[model samples]
Target: MTIDRCHQVLTAIDKINQQDPNKININGEMIAKELIYGHQMTACLNKYWPTANEYLQIAVRAQHVKRWHIARSTYPEGKQGYLTWRKDLGKMHAELAKDVMLDCQYNNEEAEKTASIIRKEKLKRNQDSQILEDVACLVFLQHYFEPFAVKHNDEKVISILQKTWKKMSAQGHEIALSLQLPEHLAALVSKALS
Candidate 1:
């Protein structure tokens, strides 16, 4: 079974509160600003918590999962293989967070807050992936393709990366609009392939 992040967050918060009275001092808007744990743990909590606060009874669940068994993907860590493995990490966290919320009855606001956190984290991770590729691509070009593109002082490789970025940025935006998870490139697989 998938672990729920909401429940875990609530548990962590409660545990912290029990340990120290001063930590839970802030309520309302300051509640979100409160820090509960270390880096990876915080990333986990934020990604799974939901946002609906008015009624406060939020339950976020991971109903389904889409996977990329193929092993190669666009970020060119060779396209499908490692890329899928990398995103699976986010899916695991998301599942954990959803379970946590279900146990706590944390309302829509809390659930949404968690979702927002995850989305933000996913974005950062995606950017990091691209940066890794961009750097490698740059070096590769410099050593090999640079001579061809640079003759007449042209930046063919650089321009290609820029254009590729334009497409990626647009794709990211579209997915955001549809509320698709950042790790959800699989949702666009057919289109991407075609």
Candidate 2:
């Protein structure tokens, strides 16, 4: 029963993400960006923490649930705007995941627990929340860093990398170091660390 409910919630989250209008090219195929991102998050979580509890698994999958609904352009252009947008997105994702969990017949307590993980409540203090942060950072480094590094200047990329590094745990740093990034991208990461 527990496993069934967890699978139901995960499937529902995937269904919602599949509606993403934005597409990303993956190997010669265009795929829904958020859907692939959810999968990537799940893969990272399973790879690094296969024994993760169901709430953590669900939270990871729902981290960016329907993210494209909130356009970054809707917020102002400064750092404050970016931070606000991120905070809003975290709230939205938490609420959406909570709703999905309830719909899947999870108790309110269970739903709220998963939502808190999605909101990253007590990030450094909460083990599940910290694991979620680690998985997100790992996924970003493995899949998104190259494209992001290509677009931004070295200084900006390094700054962003530094911020990302700060959010990750030591275990996450180890996993990130194990990734086989392209040579140029590896150099950029080295520069960022240095």
Candidate 3:
């Protein structure tokens, strides 16, 4: 029954994400960006923390739920804008996930826990939250880092990588080190750490 509820919620989230007009080409197929992002989060969670509970799984899967609805350009063009956009997105994702959980028959307690995880409450002070953060960082490093690196100057790219690295757990760092990033990006990541 619980598993069925989980699947229903996941399906609903995917459907909402499928409405996204923005798309990315993944392995020759055009797919909704957030849909692929959610799949990547799920995959990273499973790979890095196989025993993750359903709450953590749900939170991770909905990490970027309906992200396209909020465009960064809607805010002012600066660090404050980026931060505000990210903060708003986190709250929006949590609220959306909670609504789905409630519709799926999850009790308020369970739904609230999921929302808190999605909001990243407690972060480094909470194990589950930290795990989610780790998965997010791993996903960025594996999939987005190269493109992000290309768009920014080396100093800015390295600074962002440093921030990403600080958010990750030691295990996440291990997984990141094993990833085969392109030569230039890998060098920047290495330089960031040094």
Candidate 4:
């Protein structure tokens, strides 16, 4: 949001102009902040209970990190490795969620229960839409900024994707509704009182 951060993010991105750079480190924090502040995540996430912003913050940060790892990671592409990574992602996210909930003063039992649901939802995403999410992310990136077209030699493609994501949209959320996200994503669109 800050102009300095905006430039820092772009410059970080500029470095990996060659291929897929590990963008998570550079963009994850900012994107996490954007999602929080832009979505009014404080309001949306707080519906479940008081002091819920912390929960959303941790999950958002964790999700951004997980995606960064998946996209930029160099592990041999295989069914088992991908599945393991997916499970690990879910576990880490849930743990982060639990930490936030407990910090917000929720009892350990309640926090654990909430984190369990989060974990389940996270895994369900791997099952129902991970591929869709991946494709959608790539397509959106290509369409708006064409970062991959930078001709990465694989080493820098991750960087390209990361930088492109930050540079393409800060508060300009219109593309997300119509981009690669499922039809459900569009439901977030506002229908003013008529």
Per-model TM values vs. the true structure: 0.27, 0.97, 0.96, 0.36
Q: Candidate 1 overall Cα lDDT vs. reference?
A: 0.36
Off by over 4 Å in 1: 1-79, 121-194
Candidate 3 CA-lDDT value: 0.91
Model 2: weakest 10-residue lDDT segment is 183-192
Candidate 1 lDDT by residue in tens digits, 1-194 = 12354345545444432432223234433222123222223232234323332111111112111112223354456447565655664455344455456466656555555544433344335543232223223323323243444453324444543443443344333432343222323233223333
| Candidate 1 minimal-lDDT segment of 10 residues | 55-64
Q: Give residue 82's error in model 3 in angstroms.
A: 1.4
Per-candidate local distance difference test: 0.36, 0.94, 0.91, 0.39
- As for candidate 4, its clashing pairs are 19-156, 19-157, 20-156, 20-157, 20-158, 20-159, 21-158, 21-159
Scored against the true structure, residue 145 in model 4 reaches a CA lDDT of 32
**Residue pairs in collision within model 2:** none
Winner by lDDT: 2
Model 1, 132: alpha-carbon shift in Å? 19
Candidates ranked by lDDT: 2, 3, 4, 1
Of models 3 and 4, which has the larger lDDT?
A: 3
Ranking by TM-score: 2, 3, 4, 1
Model 4 whole-model lDDT (C-alpha atoms): 0.39
Better of 2 and 4 by TM-score: 2
Residue 179 accuracy (lDDT) in model 3 = 91
Taking every candidate in turn, the Cα RMSD to the unseen true structure, in Å, is 15.9, 1.0, 1.1, 13.2
Highest TM-score scorer: 2
